[model samples]
Target chain A: MKRIILALAASSILTAGAASAETLKVCAEGAYPPFSKTNEAGDLEGFDIDIANAICDEIGVTCELQATEWDGIIPALLEKKCDAIIASMSITEERKKAIDFSEKYYNTPARFVARSDADFTIDEDGLADMVVGVQRGSVHQDFMEKTFPEVELQLYGTQDEVYLDLQSGRLDAAIQDSIAADDGFLKTDAGDGFAFIGGNQNDPAIHGEGAGIGVRKEDVFLKYALSAAIAALRENGTYKEINDKYFEFDIY
Target chain B: MRFELALQHWEVFASGVWMTLHLTALCLLIGGCIAIPVAFAMLRGGVSGWLATGYVYLFRGTPLLVQLYLVYYGLSQFDFIRETWFWRPPAYLRSACIEDLMGWKVCAADFIPSLRSAWWCALITFSLNSGAYVGEILRGALKNTPKGELEAATALGLTDKQVRRRIHIPSAFRRALPQYGNEVIFMMHGSAIMSVITLQDILGVGRWLRAKYYVPYEGIVASAILYLVITYLLVFAFQLIERRYLRHLNIKAPGAERGWFGRSAV
Candidate 1:
């Protein structure tokens, strides 16, 4: 009985310590490189990680990064597995119905990547029966489904898998974030023959107001805090520093 | 549990159900066909038997998910497979091979297209995995065939092939029906992994729904209910088949009527 009471007292003390420490658990996709990725040392690095850390620092909280798969990232946040999603999640209306988003930190248009030698126009007629790959549950999938209903769409769990299928000639083309496609695939050795096919696809209705940190609907305080942090980072040149480290061009 | 979300997206779930059903049916049909020869070979007890045993052991020894990943992802990694093996023919051949047949543009060159498609990869992997399991079940049933029946057939001057075909295989099939039914249901459940390779089977739709709405339980609960319905239907089918074929194996109740064919009606 005495030992049990002692254990309960110790658990209460741990809980109190946890409540006192202001740690913001941010979920990011480790598979998405340049934005966020796990290095050879198993540490999470990249633009998303840096931005998330900066936001936590501005909010006077310790940032804890959790690597999550893209497919279940939103659900993870809703389940309170993490406090926020700093993954490159587009602020679309459909997603807004499920979770609230901070102001956009970065915005890039979607683009289609295809083999360089493949001669095809980027239109409904050109891709009528072609199989186009997109990451499952992404805005790109919604855009493709709405824009080209006749085309066969193959959904992959990750952008990397879409690139893999594209490389193997299974996919006629793939739709993804332009910068992601450029850095993650087209710039790599495995993407030797592939090149961006279409022009920027920034349909406001589908691609939304650009990528933002996703927070729960009821976490209004956190959302505002994140939006303010993003603005502060931009003003202090911190955002530019992270952007320059990842890309040559302005991505803000 | 926002089940309303599942109800609202019934069409998506229906499509997922359709994919799962077709995949399961194709795998079972192809797997059952492969199992027969493999079972016979195993019974024959030669080098062929060893080969059959090895095939079964290899597939059954590993998880179905690993086998699926190997086929779907691993196979596409090889340039030879992507470029040549089972790939579409050259442009010249492709154009020349095109012929209209009953309003459908049929191209002979397109017959052996690459195996990189998710449907093809899933079908091939699931079929092979199902075949290994069904083969082992059939082999076990064949081995357990009564020695007296084989001897009786031999005494009647029936050829080895005749006795094996007429009596040996049929009896074993009847005995194997119950176990094979279970294998069918197992294959259906195992097919949920199709989602991993991006084929929108039942579980895939569920995952998609969860990802879309961020409602964790609705999609999963909906999927679970659909699986339960499928399993119930499968159980009913197996029961009907068992009643028709294996009724003779059941002990007769008092005053039960025997059918005209010398089988109990009950």
Candidate 2:
């Protein structure tokens, strides 16, 4: 009886393999530059996309970037809209609820943006009575609201929209990832009159260490593979190679 | 996951929720106001109507994100739009009342986005898309009007305009009531998509909450609650409208709708 059961189990596993083998479907917000944005030809090109591709290459698995909206990215992942989220999403205590995150990959400073004319430097020491704009559902929003309620905090839908208002002079300044501010707004004519206020501040309590890949908690095997792959890539110069291509500085 | 930890920040979350509700409501009110005329002109106007058709088609068909980029980024690229009558009021500056500030001049056109981009994006999409849907609804309701009623009005020496205004529109609205309610539901759901362009709807807050705690479950749950609340409110409002408009529905029994269900029912 035991032999018969064991043979059936083995047969089922083999048949399952024959029926379908899984490929890693990586999710990235193709609109976000440097971290994850699309090229003119609609190709995924960003720091996270490069890293995901390299990791897949190392694992000898076919990895695909599935462009999805940032708001629904996590929900889509939970519903299997793709396999993982490699977007520069922070691995915060709150996000860990629905899905699991890989180890911290990169840590970027969070800064507030103001029009060139506005002298409001975000009082990193205290936030009160100052209105700050940050992307809705970003660490910057959480930090501003939680740590500095004294200031007015405005939340936008995407990283770019936050800067649009800053340049238009509707906001005192926008609070966002420095890299995003630098790549998305700082380098452009829209951002010509803008400056990063309050220097780079790292408040890990609010701004969780830089983003990590997201996977279903039940995806134990894939998670283990990704965690290992991430470590190896960091040890090698692969991480730096990808980072230097788009950004002036290595994000990791 | 400790629920209390999140509950501790309930005030902030509450504020976010309130803002989202206010934003959605304002955008809908504003977007709807603009769309009605735009749709009417498209259907009624001559060559200029084609422009309306194009406007509706482009805004309705494309994803909200692209539209937002085209609006926010694409517009800023041109010096003409920045200088044109459209970009009036000189952008959001000084946080003071200047009555002359008109069009895209308010800083929020780019800066303080409570719901304007979401509104513009939503309005453009909502007004245009809803215009498309409402246009079809209007067309159908117009066609569905009883021929006998129009003949009777004509017999009374009423002009086409008077007949439409006094009798046709009112009767047609009554007929379109249920379907219009349904459209309201769809618009409510469609509003969630606005979050992509960064409208901080309930879903937006849920995402931020998730990003903060790394607790996707909690944030998602909170989002579900928010959605449920908004949906419930919309549905409640829909019910109120139905009850008010379809009060006649109550006096009749089931299957007694005497709808325009063809002569077979009579």
Candidate 3:
């Protein structure tokens, strides 16, 4: 009975692999809004997801959008849990050393947001006493750590959690991607008192080139395929249609 | 590759270790203090018993991470807390020691301010969580204190306080020490979650190092080794404490003389 069960399990596993072989597994951080987020209906619907589906359409492959925690997205790609990461992961030199990234899909600047009533500057001296919030394992965290070493940083697991702290006045300010702040927080009712405090921060060392789909270093073919599909989407006006649905200006 | 990177960032690891050690130690001490009273209340029975039971159940039922969020983020949602100030303990302490410390201690005035602080929030959440588990362990130990000893103490004309002080409490602690040691180790492991709140514990430092170097293995392995070392040291310390406190309960071995795996080679 044991031997028969083992053989059956093996066959089932093989069939499962075959089923997924033709499907293009695209992982995304569903918590990051405007880029990618889960809607009220428990479906992922956002710029990154739309863009990913468009790329799949261009490539003539069945697309599967999988929501993954941003922290584990790269590890998931490396482990073959997914074939590629369309998680709005910035194409930084540091990240490129580990995983391959396709051509830039979108570039968003970083900025600090605070309550409109509070008069705090975005500089080291200005932020010296203030408690700042940033998402853990994000480039903004790296930027804040390096730029404002003296400021008290409260790192949240998700970008939305940072807004929560900022809303409650627990955090004096929050540093994050500007577009994310605009669409995810500032535009919402919970962000009634908050406004962007400073000019956009754009240090390439931290912010990197832009967000790109991440593939494993060995998956050169998939990387090339994804890059081509992205380029085709831009040239064929599909990218613009999707872009207009989410944002006012060009994100590419 | 990971080891080389870890070695290069030794300072970060060291700082992380220091933070974890202090956070764990503080949490354990505070939690243990909270646990003892809760255990007593549980033993007493009635409304206080139910209250204590509810406290334990509430903490144990929820994830420590959620409890942390509730304290750090959820509690601050109220306007009363954000706009108000209460008595400050650190300020009072610094004021008391102002003359001796040459006013250099004035900086500590705001250390434990009345306002909500993320550090305090994390500490309180960890302590409450630890208190529940520790309380249950202690309650079990307290109940297991031999009834014969209590009867004998009463027969010897001992007062209730004397009986508890001389017999029950010490025996209960001695019995609970091993399980309590496990709780301490668990608390130490749980302290890694402090990284999410940006407190820079050993795990937090590891995270920072990984993000800075873009090498997860190096940071993760380095932190794991540090945690293992800390756990080993904690267990060793508990063993020493057990030996000292439970010396009277030790018995001679009935098995073969000690060797690898607690048995001599045939």
TM-score of each: 0.88, 0.66, 0.85
Model 2 has a DockQ score of: 0.22
Per model, the share of native interface contacts recovered reads 0.68, 0.27, 0.38
What are the per-residue Cα lDDT tens digits for candidate 2 across B23-66?
55665565556555555566576876787667666666786556
Q: Write one digit per residue (lDDT tens) for candidate 1, span B176-197.
A: 9999999999999999999988
CAPRI class of candidate 2 = incorrect
In model 1, what are the clashing residue pairs, if there are any? Answer: none
For model 3, the stretches where C-alpha displacement exceeds 4 angstroms are: A1-21, A40-42, B86-106, B109-115, B253-266
Predicted candidate 1 versus true structure: per-residue lDDT over A19-99, tens digit per residue: 234677788888777788789999999889999999877777778889987878898888878878999999999998889
| C-alpha lDDT of residue B196 in model 1 | 84
lDDT of 2 by residue, A96-185 (tens): 777898777777888777766765446753445444677665667777777676776666656766666666544666777888878877
Which lDDT tens digits does candidate 3 get at residues A9-92? 334323545325446778888888878889999999889999999887776666788888666567667667777899888888
lDDT of 3 by residue, B1-266 (tens): 66787788788788888888887788888899999999999999999999999999999899888888787777777887766552224434546544446644544544564436666777788988999999999999999988986788788888999888877887788879899999999999998887776588788777666655556466777899999998999999999987756555564433323421122111
* Rank ordering of all candidates by lDDT, starting from the highest: 1, 3, 2
Rank order (by TM-score, best first)? 1, 3, 2
Q: What DockQ would candidate 3 receive versus the native complex?
A: 0.31
**Residue A7 displacement (Å), model 3:** 35
Query: Please, what is the whole-model Cα lDDT of each candidate in the order they appear?
Result: 0.85, 0.66, 0.79
* C-alpha root-mean-square deviation, each candidate: 6.4, 8.2, 8.2
On the 0 to 100 scale, the lDDT of residue B148 in model 1 is 86
